[model samples]
Target: MSQKSLLLTAKQGSFAVGTTPIPKPGPGQVLIKIQSAALNPVEWKIQAYGLFIEKFPSVLGSDIAGTIEAVGEGVTGFAKGDRVLNQGTRGDNNEFSGFQQYALANADVTAKIVSSLSFDQASTVPVGLATAAVGLFNQGKSNSAGLYPPWEENGSGRYAGQPIVIFGGASSVGQYVIQVAKLAGFSPIITTASLTNADYLRGLGATHVLDRKLSAEQLKAQVSSITSASIQIVYDAISEADTQVAAYDLVSSGGTLVLVLANSIPESKRTSDRKIVNVFGNVNAPDNRATGASLYKQLTRLLENGSIKPNRVEVLPNGLQGIVDGLKKLQAGVSNIKLVAHPQETA
Candidate 1:
């Protein structure tokens, strides 16, 4: 069978909504009929800057939600027609990427999408949630803070009195960080976002939503008023050089700060007392497979109970073709919502 896919025609070239052959699932993988595909900033960056992608006619999408068409060998507990969501990777071959109507997903890291959530909504979870989960709990000083994961024994509510200062609480990853941090029992979850998003972030478990417009000094002052405890963990979802510096300064000595992007904290300001970790959020990567599988195993329970929530999603029209414009909107900047495209709607 053939499928409609959004293909990057070439490096720094145009995106073409065209046809590609549907792929079969390999061992320990499942073939997915993608219903919804979410657009991320990295997808656009790859085309504009020729970043991670090298092959011609590559597919570049990460978050996907769909139903299983077939299951490969040894993939128990999942079967044909199982509703699922997973993180897809863009490689030289591009068969596993989510921009196409049919893609291959490793069964180990694909989570069942509960009845309460639509495919569009589920499409928002994998990338943002994985980034937040991997950065906060993945074991390893290089990849994360190595904090206890909430899914582990008594890991929930483990940091009762600790304070977490998250820069950019309204971003997709920021929303997940707030929810996961709350599940981990962090006290006084503090974040910076537009004042308009304060209530939304608070509903996600952030205790205080400081203005993103605030200067570092102003933000620090507001955080000070919220709790006298030192800020031991800071997750900078924004991770701009300026924000990273401020977040680094807020982390207590011997504590860790997480950045979603490269470390831009100037060497003049860097210190050894604290650590800064840049997160690679793709769970499908060989290195993160163990953590990814563990997360997928518990994802259904977390979503069913509303302990972890998908970001609010805005679905674009015309399926895969709509993703072109949607990426433009993402690049122009969106606030507090995920933009999703329906792959099956291609025409």
Candidate 2:
């Protein structure tokens, strides 16, 4: 069977809408007729910096929401027609990525979405939530905070009264970090974003939303005034050099700072008491598979019980073709929202 896809023609190449054969599900996998595919900064970075993907004519997308069209052997608990959302491999597998109308997903990491969520909303959850969960809760890992997961038994509210700060609260990953940190009982959750996003972020469990425009000194002052407790964990979702510096400075001695991008802290400023962790957010990576599976197992319940919420979504026009422009919008910058496209609507 044939399907429409948005293909990156080469390294540092343009994305074009094209035809591709729909792949059948392999064992332990399912084929999804993708309804919504969300854009991420990494996808644009891949084009701009020629990163991660070495193969040409590659399909790129990491967040997908759709209905199962077929289930492969050995996969139970999921069947055809189930509404599901899963994170596609980050520039690793074309048939498994989200840019196509139909893509294969690992059953272990795919979660059923509740009827309450539209495809566009569900599409935003995988990457953002995985990045948040992995960075904060994946225990004993180099990329994570090594904290106990709140999704486990008696794990909820595990750190009540402890303060956590997240930079870029309005970014997709930042939003999830705020919510997950709340679940872990991090009280007085603080984040940096524009004033316009303060109320929206607060509703997502952030106790304080400082302006992202604030200078490093001003941000530190605002955070210090919010809580007298030492900040042990800081998640820099923006991961920009400046943000990383500010976030690292906020980490009390012996504390850890998580960055979404590569570490850029100068060696002169580094200290033995402070630690920086650069997060590799995709769950499909071999190291993160177990945690990814575990999260997917409880994802439905989490969504149904209102413990996890998706980002606000803006659906772009023109389906697969729409994503080219959507990536541009994401590259230019957006706040407090996820951009998504309906691949099936591609013309």
For each candidate in the order shown, give its overall lDDT on alpha carbons. Answer: 0.91, 0.92
Model 1 — which ten-residue stretch has the worst lDDT?
A: 137-146
lDDT of 2 by residue, 1-347 (tens): 79999999989989998899999898999999999999999988899999988877999998999999999999999888999999999565689999989999999999999898889899999999999999988887898988888998888999999999999999999999999999999999999999999999999999999999999999999999999998999999999999999999899998999999999999998999988887888888887899889888999999888889999999999999998999999999998889999998887
In candidate 1, residue 162 scores what lDDT? 95
TM-score against truth, every candidate: 0.98, 0.98
| Superposition error at 78 for model 1 (Å) | 0.9
Model 1 RMSD, rounded to 1 decimal: 0.9
Itemize residue pairs with steric clashes in candidate 1. Answer: none
Off by over 4 Å in 1: none
Which residue runs of candidate 2 sit more than 4 Å off their true CA positions? none
Clashes of 2: 0
Which residue pairs in candidate 2 have backbone atoms (N, alpha carbon, C) closer than 3 angstroms, thus clashing?
none
